[model samples]
Target: MANAIWHQWVGCEYRVLKTAKENIVSQRSASPVLSSYARLQRFILTALLCWTVFTPGAVQASEELHYALTVNVNFGQDLGQPLGSLFEVRDSQGEVVLGAGFASVYNTMLQGNRHELQLYLHGDRDEALEISSLPRPSPAMGTFITAYNGELLANAMNYGSPMVWDSASTTWREDTTAPRYYQTPVASGNLVFRPSQVEYQGRTIFASERTTALFFYGAGNLFAWEEGESDLSKAKVHAVPWTPDRDRADMDHAATLELATSSAFPYCYGVLDNEVLMVSNLGWLYGFDGEQWRLIQDNSGNVFQMYTMLNVYDRLLLGNFPTGGIYAWDGNTLEFVSAPLDYAHSGMFEAQTFALYGGDLYVGMWPWGELWRYSVLDNEWNLAARLFSHPERDSDLLTPYRSLLRTEFPSREYSSHSLGQRVYSLLPLSGSLYASTSARSGRDGRDIFHFLSQQELDQYGAVHRITAPTEASAQIRWTGEPTTFVLEVHSDSLRILQDGVE
Candidate 1:
């Protein structure tokens, strides 16, 4: 703690400059009386102009980026099957080689880095898959998703209880040595904050429950941590070399690193300021500085519940519960960024997911599947659109069609619960935004599809164009012959002021 310090300076600094208004008036005026009046007026106007331009309170209006909001694709219709949770896997070229769903994963055939849908095929629906270390030509299963009772996808990789999915055998093998981990659903009153992956000393490390796997490069050798003891200060900490390809008998003994922390199960993980950060379900923020873990920030138990955490401009932004507002920690205190978080149903509709597109934060809500945009520059939030991508038929046309039918038909049923939509996932693929929805009604019912592009955002509305005044002039006709005077704009400056005086 001796090395950490929070700096605070409440005062602002400003600068004052001397202008040449008197010199300009003397040079431009022919009569002394006119020159005197002109000089006074010019001096007053110059002072006001400078104040208007340099004042700290003067804020420039923010600009909006356009996006073409449209339904590019529908997964259910395309596959002729219902969809569940969706995940993305990238190839060696960094292109999406596969789109994995809870029920099945689709193989994306490519033509020079672009996916050619004609050659696509679907894989096992019930099988859960996680990408292997080297995701090239194809991705091997490194983990599996299991619903042990009521548990949801607790790990950041979106799986529970770490297990390796052997592609050849098509079976999930558990890591018997790792400590047991459980992530309760948010609706169940507890948050599941799991560490996804972090880059440490050039190697990628992912933690599932208490088990930590360190992967190396090339014909790389993998490693794992030993089962930690109950001691918070001196938990077991050692590393043993292990190879996944070798026989289970040849697997080396696990080593451990006695990381100090109060939170027994930590799920929320992020990297900030070159440090690996972890947030526990208990609301404690821990940072790892290459050597040991240190508790950097902590909120009272059950006081500050974080729904989603994101990194924007290198700083961590957390979507908090109850308030539904976004908060950022600036190495010291938390700064709240206000938005219209209040929906028809309060905290029930929390921001479950977040994505940064075109400098704005797109927040996807739970249960409702609504989308909201937070203007980073203006510090405001607005209802961008809805996730329920269904169109209603006009009664006038439907009435005639219904009468023309000889036999009775099944009419569209309307119910409150039946009309609900929930956004299960929000992904930014290529130049568009792909969203997956779980709805009971509408075209989006149980659909895993739709991509919104910049063109769609542009179609939403035109951005207001703002331009500086290009010309400045004055009139002079004291010598009988009419003369038009042109004022030449020179330089501009700004200063932050504490008070009226600089």
Candidate 2:
């Protein structure tokens, strides 16, 4: 590994200006980190940020243009998904120059969500702001949630193993021993293992698979709790995943009292009124107070199933799947924040993901891949854009997609693996918001769905960078003196961050 200020990379030298604040690249301490020779491939690379000055026609194959930085980063052997253009570079008009990112084409279920954080690397050492690559998982898959809490942990989804960067060993290792991977459900095979659900509560990050939740604290501590108490039978389980139930039928509902202490699929670790409150997919509300479990509510039988949750201006907003709304838990019942985000579509209209761009809330829905923006100035929820426009999906008809309500409701049918769509992730980067979509389950980066045309199939697992329309004035909202935006996905949203908020 070659020397670097923030991260160790081979074949290239990286240096950063510490004045970049939140986006700054620097080591934790003043001591120099050791480096070693790595087995990384070499490539002749140059970042031509001065493209604005160049002519329109192409030059000779061997021709070299005037460039800013010659950088090549494939930190964990991520060669195919190479670092695309320089980020945060502006033209004379202060517009974002480069527009490229590593996007998955087929299997969004596992490979759909890769975030483009910072791609800045000037030629000068002191004035340069380098963008380093995150290490891939050992048995590599895709980049989903890359969290930094003094240490870097990049998580691949269900099928792929999670990889943590070992600063001690100076290598990426499969997260097998530190705390074991969450086990598959009882009597269930690997198919029941959904994608890992990652949520944050206070200074803790909770990443779950099946019944177990792995907690990573900001102070560099990690623990996995697969056990819980039962609300139905009042049974106790010490090292438990007593909430037993597959996605298809009621496996947990038919269990006896003695073995009912197990848990089901957990969604988010919600903190309300200073207590750790968490809800299961089977409508089980549990509270853990650093000691034992307490059942808060049991709204079982498909009552209130939520996939994602967010904290919107002090309100804990939970994304309800069955009800098709944005709700908040009030210690007793779920109240509506935004009702039925996408009623225009059939199938489960779930508010699956969310993001905060320009201090306004933007929510992404499922099945139809609808993205909505909450207009605080207008006090209404507006349709931002439909991220997916597959020709097969009609606004009036919804089926052909896998849903959780398939078994319960006879009319709700499960389709093939390529039919489902989830607006899986919403990321705000480079002053623009990007939404990602995923299938129910997909192959290892292969788009075997011959049914979809290339134009229609492109929507799945694609990150649509929100750009602007022609009429910029209608998109702007004047807040007395300063100007806010009604449509968050405007051309101005593509500008580089001035205040450092992605």
Candidate 3:
């Protein structure tokens, strides 16, 4: 019966007997019904094998996806915190495809506490990748962060450490070849880099902070460090002093003395065509000509106290703090542009907004991230967008966000450090936006959060959960595309997958 069943399964192959002996052997071994069943089985197996050989699987290749990385700084009781805890996404060749960090914060903290954040990129496959922290510097103050020109390589500053990202070895090496003159110890206080430029001695210069004073370092010279190193050592540091200077060479000496004597030291400074334009906190505008400084305008005697200034198209656009009023500097005179809303105070601590894009002026207001587009032809301010924290708002500020930093959208404003878990800085990289939060959360320990693209958030949800600990770490991935993708959040891992596969 078993032989009959096998032959029946075999089907047509059993009918074409090659020899009488074979047929006789089959007859002796199997019943007719069994042979027929065996033949059928064999025929079915052959057809299935042929069909499988010709047909392909149904699944298709997944779409390429991008992720924005958000890192949260969690300080523990032990001062021995790690430095340069970088969260980087690399390609199969181990080349850094995207990277970001709070450069200003890391550099500021590296001198006092042994806390550091180091993120290294590893792995070449699509499998589970491990992200581990690097060792902390001994007696570390805190990790200070800085990014490459494009924010591709986010770096941490420790004393005597070099700054080099090795693409071949897939590592960051200390830049030992950097001229000794270029190497300066990280400043010892809270510092932020501004995009202002100054002109001195017929040369354009840029200033960055060292402690309290702004160091006027010349621009356009890659080897400017030779001059900076020499000048920095003998650099004459000035404060908004209130004491009258005995030396006449100090342009601000008298003003410093006055500020010292008086209760107010009202001064605002901005970069105007390679010149450091100083507006007294009391609203006086002066032009520093690199050697001697002279007063250009005294608005303290007028109606406005200049909080921020931007030189646009040979005209100066001045913003009054607390109040959302604006003024224009047109060569020979200052003209009032507009005033704040009725309910808004002109003196509230607000961030000044001046970003030049496509020949138009983009001005952002503090507290509320309201963006306005300034038209040069009509002399009008148009409501462009308002950055909001909520996802349901009608504002287009968070949609189709583009940045050079590839981390977070640059439109958002960060709250002060005292405001825990708030954002502090916004960086734009490779058409993506990146931001750093004030601190980690107390519950889930997530200190940072990334708002996914509007399209993705709408398709999924506003908050795409990554592997950020509810308490300590914040993770964000930039989906470089403008389409929808999946954010897979698990306790042990987080991945941004396209079409449900990673």
* Candidate 3 lDDT tens digits, 1-502: 0000000010111112111222322442243222222222112111100000000111121232112222222221211111221222223333332221211111111111111111111111221212122222111211222233222222322235534434356454565433211111111111122222222222333343432222221111111111113422422223221111111112333122122112233334433333445454456665543344466865554544654544433345666655667776654566766653343453442324443321234454543444455543234566544433433422222222223213442444432221112122222222122222222111121123344443322221011111111111112222222222232212222233322333
Two-way lDDT contest, 1 vs 3, winner: 1
Tens digits of per-residue lDDT, candidate 1, 1-502, equal: 0100111111122222333444434443432222222322222111101000111111111121110001111221111111121122222333222221111111000001001011001111221212112111111111112222221111112223444334356444555332233321111121121233322222333344554322111011122223344553432323223222222211234333344442233434444443444454455666554445567766755555555555443255665544556666555556776545544224334454564432345676644445676643334566666643333322232111223222322353323233234443443322223343433322321112223233321211111111111111111111222111111112221111112211
Which parts of model 2 are misplaced by more than 4 Å? 1-263, 340-347, 400-418, 443-448, 467-502
- Sort by lDDT, best first: 2, 1, 3
User: What CA RMSD would candidate 3 show?
Assistant: 25.8
Query: How well does candidate 3 score on lDDT at residue 187?
Result: 15
Q: For this target, which candidate reaches the highest lDDT against the unseen true structure?
A: 2
Poorest stretch of ten by lDDT in candidate 3: 1-10
Best by TM-score: 2
The residue ranges of model 3 lying beyond 4 angstroms of the native Cα positions read 1-147, 152-211, 216-268, 271-275, 280-284, 296-307, 330-332, 339-351, 375-385, 390-502
So what's the TM-score on candidate 3? 0.34
Residue 112 accuracy (lDDT) in model 2: 17
